[model samples]
Target: MDQDQQWLINCLNASLDPNHQVRNFAETSLQQASLQQGYGLALARVAANRELPFGIRQLAAVLLKQYIRKHWNEDEEGFEHPIVPSNEKVSIKGILLASLDDPYKKICTAISVAVSTIAHYDWPDDWPELVPFLLSLINDQAKLNAVHGALRCLALLSSDMDDMMVPKIVPALFPCLYTIVSSPQIYDKSLRCKSLSIVYNCSSMLGVMSGVYKTETTALLLPLLQPWMEQFSSILK
Candidate 1:
């Protein structure tokens, strides 16, 4: 590792130290470091590194999520957080999704939250490829952790998607969700539950959309309704 990365790892370790002074000092140093270019990407790398201690990795993941929230959008009206450099944002976004496959559940959850936060501001417009990229991961049965990570992100995003986004994502997302929820032998119960939750959230969004975009919403949901109902029945049983 480079000197900067090593120093970051040290700060992450110190932040978790029981000593108040040491932890405070480390946090101050980290806050200052957040202004530097590549800081977010560094935290991402540290979080994804399996060689690091679990606590350190988890802290890095959590900090990275906060970093994205604070610095991502420069144009938001009232936010005072400094804008993350555009080049750094591109670099960070590129690798951020891959970190979803981290074996540690906490790390994966943190990365998923980070992805959802980024998607909130960037999806479809700035991040045109987000849904397709996530769909690829969800469909990749070879990597269960990636699938879990993708599902976590989708679950979070589903709850808050607007009408335009609902139609764009639901048709693609429901089929994949159905695949996971229906295959009890292939997916764990928790993953199936998560898929069901996304379904619920998406269905709620569709219910709201039905009033305004009735024809489009109906066409989007019609084919999948029966199969989804069957799966829901199976789960209830």
Candidate 2:
């Protein structure tokens, strides 16, 4: 059993190796491990270990997350198998949130990938617990793509919630978004405009029908649009 475990671990690590055949063996081992004694949790530790090679550990993390996401959803039979929670579990979202500041570019990219995958699953009402973390990432200049991806994921997560959720979400998001809109920096200008476009596209989805949109929309746009038109008229002179 010890030798077999060693052989399996070797195979698993090999799959992450640069060599193709070794990688294939590793894939086969993970498949076998899924069907064997410890199941996914056995491999999860191997993935979560920071001491491991970043690429190999990341591969393990991705596989383990896929396994967790599949069976954890009551609505969808994720991965179509029973999942055992790991003893030393890692919060996938929490890790990604931290990754927004990772000095490594690939780590930032990995967090973006993780956010995209997690957003596909059904999130609970309490899921807004991560909003502050996502909001923090929105200002991370070092990893703009991660911030952009986080904002998009936040938008998607909030979009399906009740109107009760909006007040909690918008206040946190709007300030940064508004600053993005007002910034003279090229990247900030583009991000702010795109985010506002998304907000407007989904504006009618907001539960508050208190004329807030009518009051604010007209107030903000009329001045800008009217002045732009007047300038155009004068330019023709």
Candidate 3:
């Protein structure tokens, strides 16, 4: 653990140097630390320091978030590895919720990653509380990149979810797709189309409630897909 801490400190410092290569090396180092135990939570504790470069700290925060969310609350029977607490009293979930306000995209990504992981679980009682957090990320302006990442995560996470959760999430999710599809403001056409495709796929997977979403989802998605598909078909010919 001491070696890992030293390695993290070295990486965090390297991330701040004027040299681009050093910064890149730091980024790589941090990414490696992300795979190690306790490193992510440790980085989270230090990421908000004013002395650290904003970019480096943001990357650390994001990595920390990914580690916590991906690993949290696994059932003992389902585990491939033993679950150990980073800190016995501090909730990883609480730390992630606080990260929603982080002033960096990397931190935002961490929060998004965490939310996506929670969305994959069967915590029906917890869903009402958790849904709002996930929905809030979907609308955050400063965290648009993270929002996109979270939405993709949510789209997949919600795929096999029950109807009660699905209905509530889809209404909010559909409009996001509509905005991405209908707006000319989005510059990358291919990416816009891809985002729409994910919404469509998730919409289809709603199974029984697919009918409930038909009017709104179809109204928003079908027009955009038809022309794009036709254009592709013509090109193939």
Measured by TM-score, the strongest candidate is 1
- Clashing pairs for model 1 are none
Better of 1 and 3 by TM-score: 1
* Candidate 2 per-residue lDDT over residues 1-237, each given as its tens digit: 356545645666788688888778778767756655454544444453456567765666567566556644456654665544433223545555555544444544455445545555533443445666777777766667656666565655555655445544554565565555555463554466566654553344452533655565444344334433553365356
- Our tally of clashes for model 2 stands at 2
lDDT of 3 at 168: 53
Whole-model Cα lDDT per candidate?
A: 0.87, 0.55, 0.57
TM-scores of all candidate predictions against the true structure? 0.95, 0.58, 0.51
Candidate 3 total steric clashes: 0
Worst 10 residues of 1 by lDDT: 74-83
For candidate 1, give the lDDT.
Answer: 0.87
**Stretches > 4 Å off in candidate 2:** 1-13, 16-20, 34-58, 84-90, 103-106, 116-122, 139-149, 155-168, 186-201, 204-237
Task: Name the lDDT value of residue 230 in candidate 3.
Answer: 56
Estimate, for each residue in 115-193, the C-alpha lDDT of model 3 and write its tens digit: 5555454345654566566567656655655455555455556555665655556656666655555554542464366
Which residue pairs come into collision in candidate 2? 15-23, 70-78
List ranges where model 3 is wrong by over 4 Å: 1-43, 46-71, 74-91, 97-111, 122-124, 140-146, 149-153, 159-164, 186-194, 207-237
